[model samples]
Target: MTSDTVPVPPGGEILRYAAFTTRPDGGNPAGVVLDASGLSTERMLAIAAEVGYSETAFLIPGRAEGTYTVRYFSPLLEVPFCGHATVASAVALAERAGPGHYVFATPAGEVPIEVDKDADGVLRATLTSVEPHVEEAGEADVAEALALLGWSPEDLDAALPPRIAYGGARHLVLAAATRDRLARLAYDFDGLAAYMTARDLVTLQLVWRESEDVFHVRDPFPVGGVVEDPATGAAAAAFGAYLRELGAVTVPATLTLHQGDDLGRPGLLHVELREGDARVRVSGAAVAIP
Candidate 1:
């Protein structure tokens, strides 16, 4: 049956958690429905809007233990996969069952998440992405995107160029020549939303390289009905793939992404690409939003 035709159960209780940080005020907040067995598609969208986060996760019991079927919804639409919400939901489950491994059957694919406590006594979850791929973005498309973002072609980093990258979802990757260029992000909401909608893009992964392994990034998520996403796990995963594809980073490398600082909600994302592995791994800590 088609996704739209699938039956949705009734609504369940919703919990709130912030992913990628230890402090409740930090990281990206997401709504988590631990038992969404009864939620319908329409109802889920309503719940997501009510939660008012970038995205919310709904979990249904899976066939096996430590497994669950998951769905992600933004305020306005259902997404194929949501990284922050996935991390948040896994930690929520881990808190109840103790830190361990959990399998989430997302619309994108089977994602395996491992939750464990670090030395700092923080609960962190690492998610293995599905097979990732990158494609060269058309020059015309890049021009249009730059216009919508109020960015000039000269502001773009020629070394990184522009590309469309995908892990669980697609993102348009744009590298800025300088941190200053990336920081002054003022965009036309309607124009960008239209462009992104036409391309089925989740966000624009605007970034600037800080050092060999450190980078500053931001995501413009007009498609998700959010002005900006403080911490974007999906984009980070896709960026890992983008770097690997472009040979920008050596394999078996780990990178640190700092985001949401400009928005005053600082977040950190750890991305790792293992040797001989095609899928990227993203890890971060989460906290319950009280």
Candidate 2:
């Protein structure tokens, strides 16, 4: 059904939360429909589009308590998974149900989420990603992506090669040689969106490594019908896997990601990798937008 024909349920409230930051204006904002049992796919899409956030999450209660079947939709289409929205939804649930563990059954796979209050009395959520993998990006595809972004091969960081990374969703991981290069992010939206659509990529994880464990990043999400994602938790999870697979980071280590600074909505993402597990864990704080 077209967005114009989609129906809004009576008194259906959409909770707004900013994921990855305690402040409402900081992290990536996501719409959480706590009970979307009656909503159709088209209805969910229309709601997300109306919300105008990068993504929104709809939750349907599972047979067991503390377990939910979740769906994520960008303004344009449904995505396999969305980390920020998961964080937002988990925290939202915690506020109503009390903090603890919750499992989300997403299109990609099952994700376990843990919610707890920190020392500062702020609620934080950590999500264990589905099994992740990294694959080599075809040289031709990389060149095309770079061309669309107006980036030259020389602007790339040779240390961190281009690759396709997946934690819950897929992202093209590209590293910039300098912080300056990463900061300048004007790209051909239409062309890049087409490229990403052809490859089934969710976003381009453009990054600049500051230290072994700290990095600054950005994500261009034209295919999702957003100019950019201020803070991308899914991409951060994918990046954690990328670092482990590339042997760029020590196992059982925690890494820090700084994002959305350029957009004036700075946020932080904590990524953890355990020695025995291939799955990545992404943690962030979320606050309700009043």
Candidate 3:
């Protein structure tokens, strides 16, 4: 029998941290495992389930200098990459190892993360995303998404259109004309999960552009048993690429995305598109939830 057999408990053994916002009540909550060298995949999954967050991060390098390995899992299943967890893990590592750049080899790819102290010396984590790509959402895909979301194309912003965006995971990006439209979200969970599974989607990025550089966003994560994600750095990074590809925004632009207010856990995501690279940069802070 393989060592990846037994499952671990769900919550107490793990640490919880909110990423991308300073307040513990704000930002996206993530599970952080500081040391996971001897832990197998099964053990990690068990720990994640115990942690009970949408995504928990397992940091497996023991020390802080070399490239570390990270694994992300939700209560239900594992994912390729999780931005909030990555940020949380990076910041957690920084607190102990001192702030600096650290490379993470994840299931999705090699993710380079940097943790730095702010003016107040509070450590914040930033992750440079893998090369992201965007694709046109087809008529059938759009219709299916709308049906699952209890929304119609009429509710969509005429200018923004629809697209499947990717950084580490695939997400359908839909724009609402008003924040009110974006706020009131309801969806058929089973149907949405089925549609997402078929398309390999991770979440649905329902957004309302507040200004040229500011946006209000919400995500429905049916595939992972999450009704909604208040703040999603990965989706935000993907959305930045989508905007760039559509000429909606210029490179070297600093984009601000506000998420999770409807859930009362307001989180902020900052996306930067560099002048020469197509990959996006997502920045945020990690706050200890306990």
Candidate 4:
């Protein structure tokens, strides 16, 4: 219960971190409210469906200082960028304004963020995506998202080839030629939430590729109504730009990504990639979920 005794509740203080793990039940719990200025969008989608947590950031401060204006809610709507609620709202604003850089602006752009504090003191953050692309997933939308996840096309992964990336929101990468077919996640959640609301898609990363910089993800977010999303970090920053546009990592590389161990909540998503940066950074460590 640290982070300066965070708790409030009633009509304000949401907090509740967890992002990419470091305990506090592993990762991906989000729901920080910070200030949420005048909040509305139907009361921030009713406080993100009463803080159910698949995402729930809300900020709204910007005009200088560290900057904010974030949004993200996903109990069933409003999402333009989430990434474990922007790393649990940048370590809940670096435990109340302390860590470094910040900037958020989001509706699918200007992300920035930084935080810092590690050496065991914890509090990591990172962010940085937005300005990613990666199309080519239409083969009838990858056979209707592999027939709503009962999977097929020979369990995929012919060297990771399904794409639909995007670093701030749209996902749908696929992969999975094992790891028990990406840990058997039963899908069909309302037919993949009506096939990801007619193509905007929000999750379905689902990888596997335990080598070349290690990997193993899983997202399947039934279009944000949530069914699975333990530590997405915007689909690990659109799968590090779909593994460097499918060259499968090379540039300054960093990768790692090992999302929520088959749902027992394991979490860990470093993913770097520098050398002439094309966006994608995504770090991790965010606790305070007591």
Q: Distance (Å) between predicted and true CA of 225, model 4?
A: 4.8
Off by over 4 Å in 1: 1-12
- How does candidate 2 fare on TM-score? 0.97
Q: Taking the tens digit of each residue's C-alpha lDDT, what string does model 3 give over 39-90?
A: 7777777766666678888777735574788888877778888889988888
The CA lDDT of each predicted structure is 0.92, 0.94, 0.85, 0.84
Q: Model 2, residue 39: what's the lDDT? A: 89
Better of 1 and 3 by TM-score: 1
Instruction: Give each model a TM-score.
Output: 0.96, 0.97, 0.94, 0.35
Give Cα distance to truth, residue 126, candidate 4, Å.
0.7
Clashes of each: 4, 0, 5, 2
Instruction: State the lDDT at 177 in candidate 1.
Output: 98
Model 4 worst lDDT run, 10 consecutive residues = 1-10
Pairs of residues at least 3 apart in sequence or in different chains that clash in candidate 1: 9-38, 9-39, 10-38, 10-39
**Which structure is stronger by TM-score: 3 or 4?**
3
Model 1, CA-based lDDT = 0.92
**Candidate 3 global lDDT:** 0.85
| Model 1 Cα lDDT, one tens digit per residue, 1-290 | 12343333344357889999888999899999888886778878877887789999999978888999999999999999999999999999999999999999999999999999988778999999989999989999999999999999999998998999999999999999999998899999989999999999999999999998899999999988999999999999999999999999988899999998998889999999999998999999999999
